[model samples]
Target: MGRKLEENLNFGETESLGIAMEKEDDEIYGIKADEMKKEKRKKKKIKGEEENQNLDFSESKKKKKKKLEESQTIEIPEKKKKKRSKAEGSSEEGNGALEILEEKEKKKKKKKGSGDGNSLENGEQKHGKEREEFEANGAVVSGNDTKESRYAALTSFVESGLPDEVLECCKNFRRPSPIQSHAWPFLLDGRDFIGIAATGSGKTLAFGVPALMHILRKENRKTSKRAVPLCLVLSPTRELAQQIADVLCDAGKPCGLKSVCLYGGTSKGPQISALKSGVDIVIGTPGRLKDLIEMGICCLKEVSFVVLDEADRMLDMGFEQEVRSILSQTSSARQMVMFSATWPLAVHQLAQEFMDPNPVKVVVGSEDLAANHDVMQIVEVLEDRARNDRLVALLEKYHNSQRNRVLVFVLYKKEAARVETMLQKKGWKVVSVHGDKAQHDRTKALSLFKEGKCPLMIATDVASRGLDIPDVEVVINYSFPLTAEDYVHRIGRTGRAGKKGVAHTFFMQENKGLAGELVNVLREAGQIVPASLMKFGTHVKKKESKLYGAHFKEIAADAPKSTKITFNNSDDED
Candidate 1:
């Protein structure tokens, strides 16, 4: 009888393992449709780019064109690839994203490079047969009236009655974005999900609120170094990770959850000590994190919840190898979730390889990061390098209101410094963040800007995606982004908390080839198109309102409107 009972126990364990495997397989299934947009070509290549033709991609004609491009969209659950927009430079662009930073700098390399003329942009959503009808007439299926959406109620998840002391940390409004609406539910339930939304859409909260929910709901007994981290959120950049960490720390504080931020650029000794002591959640960039793990100061064995925020950026920045290495450190049964503003090749591939089946895909704003819907994107054509002058004029025009808190972007670090200096000379109190600045300086600059002490922040792509300075009145791109993806995130910096903001870009002559990509980006972000694009050799749709509908309306106006949020200080009065 003892031997028979032992045999029964052994069989039961094997059966349980099989059941778990089956459950995982069942939850992780997906089928990707065609993904690539047609290689943007001259009107000569495609007969139908009717200069100003309002081509709604939700149309069949465009679908037919897309099917001809690459044509393979296999919905995989665990593969990762390089996102194409990581595009580049007259100054020896290393190829896509323009310049692949050499482990060392090539300071001597300088060229008035005319143009490589490659076009990059976000691909439209995979449409089913029903999409064929919508596209034929050039109108998309109206969004399912959110009046019926599961998230119509705002006060449920957003906690109220919070003390002013906690709210004073970040001044967060008590509301969640649409992506947060769905993500919070699954995350709170300990379920993993792939969040497909635009940057600045509050995806941080989707992952953050959920993580906080777990922190709040779960009983937090005093934990030791041996106690595993409850959550591990990985971002690609120090700025982004730190930004997320700051928000999480503020939000979590009210609920009694402690979060430690880890990233490169500053000191690591502090991170080591913090991890050694223990933390409820550890948010960080991959490079610094890999070092901590290698040094044995950070341990992932105890982490059960993992989030890859801006997974596409991680893969694009060549952190896939590092991502895989880190994931390997986590427990096999851990829950993994990835959030990206754009679901490019790299993003989809990572999902296929790292994600389990049935990972709910929440594509907010068409996997374009709500770029086309919420942003008032404008592409102003500039004549050659006169971009600096054009930028000044644009700033002067937009700065007519003293309440404007703005972010200005340039392509190169040197240019960012120059712009900041020029603006400062012109009596604008501006701060800049770039790879060239000491990490501590960068953090201070960001902190100052967030505190409303610095109204205008000059930045390169490094400050583009992850920094969370909200309610910025304007975003000026003195240099056009290499791809539409960057454009999306850049403009997304403004128009946050549901407030209408303006995005003015200097589209140089060399960037004319990216016209399609630019239009697609703006149409997605809900920005109005300038007629200048048509005369300068590009096809675009007739102007229509996407999110706030033209004329700079408040995005957060729907909220019980609050006092004007500005970063300007006493010096601005001078």
Candidate 2:
């Protein structure tokens, strides 16, 4: 029994030991499997890093290549630009005129070719031809079909196509002035017209005869008892208005057309009475006319013809709003006529607004700012205080006899009165006209000046524009006016009606801003510019505005307005 028990215990011990060993082997196998899997994972990571490095290197090479190509492209254009600029410089220095002539010849050839749909080129050729013709005529005309619309300049009053009565009125005029000759046909054709000529160029008669003809042709024309003005003329100054009224009255008298003049600083009572009494034509300044129109004493509803004489001056005098209001009261289909000494941008804007889109524009001289070529412009640099002695000397030299008219212009109303006093003290027969004077006094002064009774007249810029005193042998500028344009007008006071006259201008240091423009004007008119004036650089500064100063942009009236843009926060976030 003891031996059997010992054997069984031994077998159980063996089996138990076998089971423990099996568990140990299994643990060892699991640890080896984990090590192999970790090795495989490490190998995969190394391969991924190597591939990523290769891709980075290739991408870097591509970027470098692109940069080099871009640099080459930029350099090529730079080199070409340098060559082109050098060529241009050489051409400008050597053969610019030859190039221009060759280009013109090419254009002429192109113009002779078949009429294609190239309207731009054709229009340019037409403009060139018109410019040539205008140069030949000693005038410059620009508009659509100006050549076709323009009539041959009338050499004789008989060819004026005017009524015998009207012709008789112009019998004293040796022949039509340049402006009258060119503008008569267009006006008589009942087309909208813009006449640009110097002052005293017979612009009054140019429009007057046509206006009279227009009125006479109206079958329903009212009689003197109930006559409403069929024509309206607007002037800038009261003097100009009165002058235009006088001319129209004389011309329309043979036709039994009564006219009335309306202006401020005078008795509106007479003007109102004349309106009530019935008139065929009404000539007035903007302010008084606007007052009369608003007062319901005047009616322009029947007016079929309108004239804006000295339109630029009217605008310059801040009469644009009043002029616009007056024109608004006239007939919409009215034949609009604008006669101005200058074709300024303001005048152009006004024409665009009121006149016909394709009106016949006749420029008797250059469209640029120009003085009357008949006037001899003499500029003298002197101290402001020295002007008195210089003026006395000039008067002695040019106005010693004082039989012919001598107009003296000053910068200010105070200066006009002071100069008049000085001249009076010097025992000179001088009368003064300025804004300070009463309308009656001014009228009397002008009458005396025109009649050559007081041949020496001291005045301000108010008399610079559109004052026609025949035989004004000399004009002396006691001081430069506020603008170069006014300087031109001041000199233009003399040398009118195809007569030679002299202008003596005194320039001071304060007027250096206009020195360049004055030089250009002198060169254009074939006058000599002083060396002292040329010391001021020939740079024309842009015109600054009174309201906006340097910030003012001279944008076109018809330029497109800027658009506003907005960004949404949500769009940026997206």
Candidate 3:
């Protein structure tokens, strides 16, 4: 039993030794695996180092190439600078420098042409320059020896060659406007004159003074039994005619000359009585004057001086026939004078038919349609539904005090009434003058507006042209006009008498047709145009004739009428 126990212990010891040997083999293999992993790590590190070096080398090469390119670009301008320096003394080098500048300009132009936005910006810059030039020159004179006879602008009222009485009447005026200064020399000299100027440029006094002078110079006026007028002034609207009469009467009162305003919408009894009593000047609209002339109550036999004010507006209002009839009744040797804010085709035609061949045409600004520079035009492009809110906002901003005179122009008569009612409901003091309103009411509204009794007035195009409301601070276009000319005249109600004004216009998709013209006007006046408006496109569609549609051919106003040739056939003669 003792021997068996010793053998079992030895067997157990042998088993323990075998287990220790297996453990030692496992450790040896573990060390080998660790060494293999270490070598692999070293290889990866070497490969990474090589790749980093290559990348750094490539980056350095790229940097050198960039630096070389930059140096080349920098050296070119330096060489040009050297050339410019040499060109100062050498004509040949100067030509080279000029060529270089020309190339640069060409490149710039090319770049500008590469984008539509840039091209539009260039156009704006060009228009801005044109406006600046016009403003700087003050007036543009054309026709009939303009170079020699163009009168120097009157610096003060004293320079105006007016009788003492007339000068006394003008004492309140600070200075003559540009139109008055330029037109006075021609008109007072008894020359047929065409004065094209912006509205509110003091055209009334420009022609009124000359008419008074014409009447005053006549020698046989004192002993004549006839009560015929010697001078006639035709206006487009009754309001303008009344305004002209007031001015002429006030001016002529100092000269012992009586003036009568003959217009419709008022009792004819008073007009006829005033005419029968004797008057030096007759100012009336075409329709009323034609009626009176046809009725034999008013006569134009002694009318030697005829003036058509706002001639374009009159022609636009279909007064051409009446105007021709009135002109035909006037003395053939009458001195014809026409003052227009625009030189449209129809106005040109009338001038051709009536005015002297060499009438002096004086344009105060550009002949093209342009807004008053004194007025700041703000155009907002918004949805039609948003107009009410936007208009309210603009009113709150522009007419906050509501003491200043603000004229709101709408498209239709009902729109005017609607807007007026809307403002009235908003707790605003507003008066409206539209066609739907009676003539008496219109006159009263205008009187109230002029007197500052009513600070706000809403009207259609009736009040747009030639209604000189003093101290009108703002004009808002609630609806765009059918024509751009009306738009100009509407805003022209403000910015009068050399005073600055503001015009806020609400534009919608419906007004896209006029967007181009509006943009042009704004750019010409150096006003900002919104991008949203520009998106409507800058193409101005040709105006279609109301009667002739798109196939109408626009003939020049000065073009001679085509003669209807009658063919005489030989067979018929035989």
Candidate 4:
């Protein structure tokens, strides 16, 4: 484990930390060791310290304090799903695009040959046994079956005039993930794009490289600016924007680009001064950036490259109007890029409204795919009452790796509070994030969690969207998501940036819709769809019902009032 993470663990969830030998790039993976004594000592040492530090935290917040009750064991129920509505033909669009997709599928098939059937039959599980045998026999599959075995060759080798140094950084990044492979060419060509891919597939660098290149080229051409940010990246939340800003700083430093971030809740006077000092790139959540723009503190007229980091998230957070309003102020002759992990109907409609004709539409991964192969998927079939018992048991069983961090997601703010408290009392260092927490507290909690002061966190869907924390070992969905797309974002939190991880979902009575969709998407992505989620098997459904609301969690629970929010990358962190 990194010293930074270890030193920050005040409530040390004791484990066999000594056995966690590092790997290449300072990675770690090890077999679980059995021990309980160390955990108890560490928990006792940290409990009084943490409780004293935040004695008034809950009272200070808007929500009432939670009173713990006697623990109860929840029961698991058999799954009931709508029938797999036949082997429906691929829902190909009537336009010429479907033909292109068809051609791409053909090419994909030719590349794979035999395992395609086995892959299609049961996803990663079917291949597991055979793969183990193959490995035992020293047989390897090449071509498209490989992660970085480039489905498409690098084209438009250079775009936005990035410096040689910036390009060199990627040369050592091991492999170009699907998103990077698709977006790099278009970005290098200085063309606009609507890049769609799952999280952790190198999406940061897809846009980061182009931005860096754009700045370096500009500097080479003596095209430096002191006032306006040349590139503007937006997201829906501050945490996500902050994470994006980190990526830009890391990758863009090799080039000559300097960046800045602007977001809400912080005092704006300093941000105005930062803007006056000038920056080449600005990554920020849309709300605060817009405030600065309205104040004439931040202008976009000279911005050459505009990126909507998580377009779907912006729309989901209720920022469509604000984003459009900001876009209207920018120069019309600009390269516009929109990226989303899941392309929703609203996002598609937004793309049509903004992007130029036939603008590069590069798509990768399954529609609701989780992260890469390194991330395992599991499902727990249990009722609401038994959930706490199962979660505790599972955590206890798996709490051997101190280097590992666990993120547990719940649907309701109340449930989030409950879960966090339960875990914290159980000798696990835990924190939580929901809209109810003040911005300062939220920031501190995120910082603490990131620093590993708390290795376990109970988060809402808000954390699922775009926050990029590295080295996470697992993401547990304490409650199932309302849509298949949400499920993708939830699990995508783990197995990030080529690290090995797992996603576990606990299913119950109200989670039928989500559980069903999750199974299909997992199957399509060549991931393991847990039998617990499919105990009832697939059943045919007569028709599809209109989605009742934007998100079931948001609609069902009262948290923050949903405002029209514009989400861009983090310029505040710059």
Candidate 5:
């Protein structure tokens, strides 16, 4: 009876092992469509063999179940015997075998479960094709249109509660710009967003209004003992920071919100004094903001809203670490917003770190680097060294009208000053802006340009992104920009406020890389593209470079190498 019980238990284990093997085979049943069609005749012969195997499998399963039931009956008597002799060697050995078998089955089941999870993850990756398309064309939502409908309702600035002063201030009164229309709904609802818009498409007001509204909503909350600001806006350049602060003050004053602008240049005394008194908003460059925070003068722990305007520019300027440190000091629950003209991989990574998992993404223009459609693009093919003569002739023609505000863009700081001197020698009233200029001079230069005292302004790329001077007539690229995106932004300085303007870009043989992108912009805006530019455009095979554009200035032969340092240790008393 004991031998019969042992045989029955072994037979039952063998049948269970066969069942597990058949289940694994079922998992490998996928057939490639093309391969199956080629092997259809061969498969027909195999089908008969497979049917016979299935019949045998069914019969074996039935016999196995019957054996299992019989084994259970035999095990009942064995359990009685084991109870009588629980400490016997044979009984202990039998129990040990059963325990080993159970552990092996558990491991097999675990392996199958893990395999399913891996397959599920791969399926999810395959499903992200639509998401890529939606991001590229700002058309559909990520499977939900609730937010899309809300954004669609605010096509006009009047729909969103803009103060009468702000409404009157807007050059586009009848309808909101593309960025404004898409970003208002999310910002007004206090949701996080990453907005991408062209340079002159009114991004300041897109976030400025919401910052005011958010400050007003939290007006009654008690602040810390120090005069901590409630809202903070960080920009890459001092001029841009001041421009943003001025816009915020104009729109937020009606709601009793005070804004203070802090930057590196100029006296910190006035900024500290203003912050000593309570202010609702603080707008400044990242460097000055970091200085104030380290001195315990500026407290951000109580800030309820924060905006990183021109985020891509900030990253390129090597302020990403400082920006992250400032963000860390702010309240984690704060409403965060970032705006950049181009969405690079670095910007995407920054958004992922700070924003919510599903933050609202608002893309106003084309997904790629694009110029404003309202601006007409024109390309002039010329040699690199002869661009100045062409610019002089073009300026001579456009300088006749007093309303013609011509902005000339150059590549370097020295180039800006040289051009200013050359233009001044020709009896043209020109103002130049670059990084080497003092803050006071920069302010004075901007003032003269805005007042139309200096009709033509020569500037570096610093003035490309965020200076809002009205009635700019013509933009001449005296020196070609390093990339097509910079070219787009330089031209955006003109053709603003729903008015038509012209952009003249000088293309050299080295600038053939930009021809493709420049041609696309021209074709999209319904301008006449020259045949040379169209031919050059064919060389653009893929997307433009991330940090630098197509062209980079080569290092001069006399440039000093900082990698090797020489120490002069001789002490000579003269």
Candidate 6:
């Protein structure tokens, strides 16, 4: 029994030892599996990092390639860019002429092709031939072409005899205005010219510069002791004559050219003396000039260039016969240049009589009688009784404003005087100019107004045309003008030298006739037309009713000749 118990104990110990060894082997196998899994994860992570680095390198290369490409392209210099922009601007200013001509040509061609051409192919071929000829003439039909382009080409090839001094003067005076740009070349080429540019558009300089150059270039011209003038400029008014003389003299100062002004208001003795002292250029009004020419003090036989400044105004002032007489006296070989703001039938007749058969017709903007676009037209409808109060209010407002120069226009000289007295009573520094005022007083008033000593000026139509008072901030029409043309000239006083301006017109029910034309002018200028004005555009039709005082009602032809006259009578019958 003792031997059996010992065997059983030995068997139990062996079995327990076997179980413990099995557990130890399982734990070691689990740890080895975990270590292998960690190694695989680390290898995958390293591969992902390499792929991300490759993508980053590729993106950097693309950016560098784009930069290199950009650097390879040519860049325009700043100075060249500015010059190109200037050329483009001039091209735009003069492009209207080319556009109009091409459009007309196109319409003609289209009509020809549609109606009587041989065939579509033949018509197209003909059109192409015409285009080639057109281009060969240096008139490129670009969508962006300009008549100035053709003129520029022609000028380069055709020998423009412009003096270096004149060219230098123009450069220093600033690039040519639209009128000068177009008219200068024609005038410089010694071609007769009829330029229709708006007032204050530098017409003085447009004609003056060319006249000076012509006089300076004359052969064997003595500086002193000359009885006859080389060039003659005829103007409508004394003020305008003086202004023209000043412009010509200033422009010709560089060329050592002498200019003198002759007008009726100033003493004739001084003018006679100036004429005797030998003047290269003579600018004068019709009345004074006619007297001087009749007295044999001034002669036009030597005059090579003649400019009728404000030609339309001269005709309007009944200087037509005088102008004809003067032009008839001038040498037929003289280059006749007429610069008018309007193109009336009379002006056309005058041009046909005096100018070359095919004179250079340079018209900036429209030739129709219209106000300057640079001036903002602000029409205020008011009762006749409210005009005074409104005028005062406007003056008071602008009196304290930074822009102080203001000009007020009236229909009558008496009204101008009354307004001046009233404004003066109101403690405003004001001046008056009219037909009744002496020339000295008129000159004094203009001087004071120009110097800003008198910030406000009241004047009749005498101050309307050819007055160049720079920096005039506003123009006030206290009364309606005699005509649409007059209205244009009045507002043109403020907006000079390409500067912006404002015009305030005091309108009344009596001025209804002007509303139609005024609305058209306002609309064409891209201004804000009042709703009140819109009604007049379609309603009012009478042209003479706005300006002239109401005359006797027109009697029907069949009616009695002595029928009772009802409307207000105009004093013009006297």
Model 6, 1-574: lDDT tens digits are 2123325445456334433433443353344645644643453344344446445434544654454434322244545544554576654423554566679898775443323111233223222122111222211111112234435532221144566765545555545666776666667778787776667777888888778878777787776556788899999987788778877777777787888998876678988998888888889888888898899998888888999988878988889889998888888899988888765545656776777544555556554446777888998878889999999998877666634899999999899889998887887778898888888899899988888887688999888998888789999999988677898889989878778999999777887877877877777778888887666554545332212435423221111112386998898987
Worst 10-residue lDDT window, candidate 6: 136-145
* Per-residue alpha-carbon lDDT of candidate 4 for residues 1-574, written as tens digits (9 for 90 to 100): 2233334654243223232221111221232333333442353354344455344322322121111110100111212111111122342222334566579897665434323121222223222122110110111122112233232334343532345678766766555655675666566666667666667667778888877766555653344546787788988887888788887876766666677878787788777888898688898887898888888889898787888987877887788878988888877877888887655556655565666533545555433344456668777788889989888877876555544688888888888888888877877777888877776777888887788877778888878877777777888888887666777788878877667788888888676655556666667657776677787455423223234444322110001122497988897875
lDDT of 3 by residue, 1-574 (tens): 3224325445466434434543443354344655544543453343345446445434644654555544443456746755655656654545666788789997774443322111123222222122111121456454444444345566788887567898777788788878888878777777788777777778899998888888888887784434788999999988889889989999988888888888887678988888888778899999999999999988999899999998878988899899999999998889999987765556766877887644666667556778889999999887878877777787788778877888889999999899888888988888999878877899999999999888888999989988778899999998999988889889999888679999999888999999999999999899999999999999887766545666666542223334599978787675
Give the true-structure RMSD of model 1: 29.8
Summing lDDT over every window of 10 consecutive residues in candidate 5, give the lowest-scoring window. 116-125
Where model 5 places Cα greater than 4 Å from the true spot, the runs are 1-152, 155-178, 219-226, 401-403, 531-537, 541-574
Candidate 3 is scored at a TM of 0.73
TM-score of 5: 0.67
RMSD of each: 29.8, 22.9, 19.1, 31.0, 19.6, 21.2
Root mean square deviation (Cα) for candidate 2: 22.9
What TM-score would every model get versus the actual structure? 0.62, 0.73, 0.73, 0.64, 0.67, 0.67
Work out how many backbone clashes candidate 2 has: 0
Misplaced by over 4 Å in model 6 are 1-150, 153-161, 401-403, 534-574
**Model 5 over residues 285-326: C-alpha lDDT tens digits?**
989999999999898998878899988788878898889899
A best-first ranking of the candidates according to their lDDT comes to 3, 2, 5, 6, 4, 1
lDDT of 5: 0.71
Q: Which ten-residue region of model 2 has the weakest summed lDDT? A: 112-121
**lDDT, candidate 2, 425-463, per-residue tens:** 998889999988999999999999998888889998888
Candidate 2: deviation at residue 296, Å? 1.4
Q: After best superposition, candidate 5 residue 167: deviation in angstroms?
A: 7.4
List the candidate 1 regions with Cα displacement exceeding 4 Å: 1-155, 158-176, 213-228, 254-256, 368-375, 400-403, 425-427, 523-532, 535-574
